[model samples]
Target: MRLRLLVALMGVGAALLCAMPAASYAQSCEMKLGAMGPMSGGAAQWGLAMKSAAELAAAEVNAQGGVKIDGKQCKVVVVPYDSKYTADGAAAGSNALAAEDIHLIIGPVGSPEATGIKPVAARNGQLAWNAAYAKNSLEPKFPLMFHIAPGPAVWADAVIKRAEKEFPMKSVALIAPNDQGGTDIVSVDAEAYKANGIKTSEEYYQRGTTDFAPIVTRILASNPDVVDTASSPPGDAGVIIKQLRLAGFKGPIGRLGGPGTAEILRVAGGLDVVKNFYWFETVPTEDPKVQEIDSLYKKLLGKDPVGGTAVWADLPAARMTLKAVSLAGTDNAKAVAAELRKMPVDDPNIGKGYWTGKKQFGIAQELSFPFGIGIIKDGKNLGVERQPARPD
Candidate 1:
């Protein structure tokens, strides 16, 4: 019955993934793995979605006779942990996973959590597949650490360039948090806007502030051509959009990231407010691959996938880690790290990524990915006015 149930679940997972199961095997090996991230807090969606990506990729590896390491086929066993999106929580989760002899871990989403978890990983000689924004996480700082996502530069360049060509912005106003995250967003957007001939102004708010009216009003008073919300969480972004739309500010709404913000749409009661919004959209949900993983994610939640869930790019990073382990033939942190760096820059998730970052982080262990400017039309990422360009 357990076998039957697993089979049924796999079917559902694959159905949602809309792709063949890449996780396979005859249950020959048990390779213990770890997945740590935010699973029950403000950033839970990223973690939960990451878990789905990790599990599905692991399942695919398992289905494929598992990773052939140490002269045997090892079945993947991913032990997931919630980092609570905090430094302390990340440290605790990493220690717990390490205690269980898990040397390979994926996650603790943002740079803050990734930074907290790295020390524990180094102590245990563990391998980490991380998604981060901070420069310090790159090589030398943590040779075993690999950044699996693009920085704000990637998104900023894509969105602003396209917006400049089509929408032609002269001045823009922003509502952003007053923290390091906000700082990161401001810096990236400032450079992008400057290059595109767009002057920028901002109104800052502290984290967890419920009222946006005063800030929004202040922003509108600036009479900018565009309203940009840099680094706003999905929920907060929704509120900002609704408040702006309701308060009668109608210029293109934008950010330096991807779209598929179903949760934001739901919060705003729909996408009617987002008539002209541009983001770093990489996946069109209509694609079979996106639909597949998206379906798997929704099933895992036992509800609909949240805003931007379908567009999560870290999924393939987990797959990349597993594949690297299989090739290395050992789970040794150093060995796996070397093996992962040797991986080619190609995948369905997040597009082609690289192992470059020496100039920024004193090491070349960054996994940069490809993305393009995409606009939300009728609640979908309807291609780009301009495709993203490769960096020099």
Candidate 2:
């Protein structure tokens, strides 16, 4: 009887040991979020900023004992990948992240790169927060994908409306890359200019066409009062601006997106050379909240913030996603997406944004954040001149 009782006790001990790790798993798990972008190529500045922003968000959440999910505190970790700003690179980088079991992917910013991540993200059941300025970035092709930027119509109504009041847009020359990107950008410009009683002449140039002499001359012959570089790639936009300046068009240089200030300065030798240029993307760093973010970013990344990019929006986007994780009560993609649909426009960086997309993309996943206007003076970033004003 004694031996049999001892044998039974040993059996119970084995069962307890087996149950131990299964219980502990709830206490020691980490939720991995992935970020991919061009950390090495021309868009490195933007990419690095994105990665840093995610890291900052993750750090803050982890410090607070992580995002509570499944009745457990799952620490969020941001894993970054460099996509080289190419479609192939984005696919490969995202695949690598999926292999590591990362569920939420942030970035792969811009055009073809942002487009390529859709399939990989969908296949892996990963939620993607696309921070690109591309036309198709917010398309409903991927049910799990979300856009955190404003749309073309939103910009046209705000940026262009403000431009009409500030600059002489009666005769504006619009130039962009001869691609789908240009089409989307110019489409907004056309509608906005027309609404504001401004006439616009649009000219498209093929990518890699280095000679802007003829293009600039044709643009000048039209005698435009404002030159719009809405969809020109960074390097090309800078080249066009420098050439336009050389050709003596003393009008305002403008974009609905960032004008690639570093590249523009590099190509044009600005900072006491170039005059007025306006952009629609910048953080109102004067606000104390933005100032804190700015200081933290500089300290964490060992670099100062760059204007005229999505640097301001990326951190806000991350914070918004994390907020949904808490409100959804679980980290499940669809549940978090549902909560995201109801997220408020409280992020100070991107003012007064709400989640709305059903009318535009057949899904309620786009964050309509207010965009700020930036003015460049004496070739230096003057920061935001005005915030986006939405119609009632």
Best model per lDDT:
2
lDDT of 2 by residue, 1-392 (tens): 99999999999998987766332443477888787777864456667767877877776676666777877777787898988766777888778988997777777666667678888878877787776566567667788888766556666556666665556567788887665556667877777777878788898987556778988999989998888887666666778888998898988877765435656667666755557777666444445566577676666556665533456667777887787887876777778877877767677555675666676667766666555676675556676654653422
lDDT of 1 by residue, 1-392 (tens): 99999999999997976564434332656778888777764456667665766776676677667887887778888798988666677789888988888888878676567768888788888888666565465558577877666566656765677666656689988766665446666777777888877898877887666679998888778889988876665567778888988889878888773243666666666766677777664443444555577666555445444325433566767787888887889877788878887888677644555656766777666666555566665455465443432442
What TM-score would you give candidate 1 relative to the actual structure?
0.82
Q: Give the root-mean-square deviation of each candidate in angstroms.
A: 7.3, 7.1
Considering every candidate listed, which one attains the maximal TM-score? 1
Residue 338 shift from truth in candidate 2, angstroms: 3.0
Off by over 4 Å in 2: 1-27, 69-72, 133-135, 205-214, 259-267, 282-285, 298-309, 326-331, 348-351, 376-383, 388-392
Q: lDDT for each of the candidates? A: 0.69, 0.71
